[model samples]
Target: MRRGRDEQGQVSLLIIGFAGVIAMVIAVVVDASAAYLQRSGLDTLADGAALHGADLGATGEDVYTGGLPEERLALTEPAVRAAVGDYLRRVGAHRSYPGLTFTVAVDGAESVTVRISAPLDLPLRFPGSPADTTVSATGSAVSTVD
Candidate 1:
């Protein structure tokens, strides 16, 4: 009879334990969503930078082939660098996250290729796990020949 009376309290204790587990699950969900949004933003920034670089590359190629005005070639690299730099600065400043960096690379002549990499930090991982992510975008364009 004594043991049966103590058993009544076990149900409430089990419910309380289950509630704590639910709360932790919700926290993990929120952290994962935040990390995903940040990564998407970084990817957009990379895409913009790559497009700008590709435009510059195309202009340079056109100049070499006498397809575009000579002045356009002269202005190409500086303008592209400016645009990419500005984009990086804008995106970086907008985020309050830590450990973010953008790397840019431009290549190709007639067909120009621009590559941008933006590093991000992910959240809500298993215990003792590293959370780092990189979002990359590339844009390519070919110069029109005269």
Candidate 2:
């Protein structure tokens, strides 16, 4: 009888601890899912921007006069930067994602790369996790005469 009385509330304590652990796990899952979704969206945006840049920047007026190249198209940094900026504004990227930042680079005179970053607010946060984080994505496109 004495032992039973002493252990009366032990199960309740165990249940409470389990409940806490469950809540933390749920929080972690929710935050991680949110981050993954954000990254996916950014990936799409970056791909579009890179493709647009490659299409417009890889061509020069000489292409019209001289005809399409026998090899890979030549990519220019200035032209790619301008084209990327234009695409972002045309697609309303800034309006879609707050605190979004991006960079465009001409790679090896044949391809263009776009890297984008955006701030994400996690739906839930655990004790060791952050409520806010930055998610990034990179996209590249190569121009071939074929």
Candidate 3:
């Protein structure tokens, strides 16, 4: 009779432990999903910014002889950076993501690249896990004279 009573409480303890583990697992999954979605959004923003910068670079090029004389087209570093900054500002990306930070660079003479990063806040914090996670994304676009 004593052993039966002790075993009855053991199952209850096991159930409680299992429930706690399940809750932690759920928290982890939810946080991870949120981070993934944030990263995806950042990537899309970077791609759009990069494309806009590249288009600006293309427009800034001087077509010698109207697409003749080797079609002098070039993407300067300053121009690319300025274009990316303007695009971000115009699209209100900074306002949308308060923690967002980005960098723009001209990749070679014909391509522009943008790297975007943002921090994601987790609803639930687990032991040994960070409360905020940083997500980063990069995008590149090529300028074409024709």
Query: Per-prediction RMSD in angstroms?
Result: 5.4, 2.0, 2.7
| List of clashing residue pairs for candidate 1 | none
lDDT of 3: 0.81
What TM-score do all the candidates reach, one by one? 0.57, 0.88, 0.86
**Candidate 2: which pairs clash?**
none
Clashing pairs in 3: none
**lDDT assessment of candidate 2:** 0.88
**Best candidate, lDDT-wise?**
2
User: What's the number of clashes in each of the models?
Assistant: 0, 0, 0
Compute the lDDT for candidate 1: 0.55
What would the TM-score be for candidate 1 when compared with the true structure?
Answer: 0.57
lDDT of 1 at 132: 62
Q: Write the per-residue lDDT of candidate 3 for residues 4-70, one digit (tens) a residue.
A: 3445678889999999999999999998898888889889899999999888855554533345224
lDDT score for residue 72 of model 1 = 29
Full ranking by TM-score: 2, 3, 1
Total backbone collisions, model 1: 0
Of candidate 3, the 10-residue stretch with the lowest lDDT total is 63-72
Model with the higher TM-score, candidate 1 or 3: 3
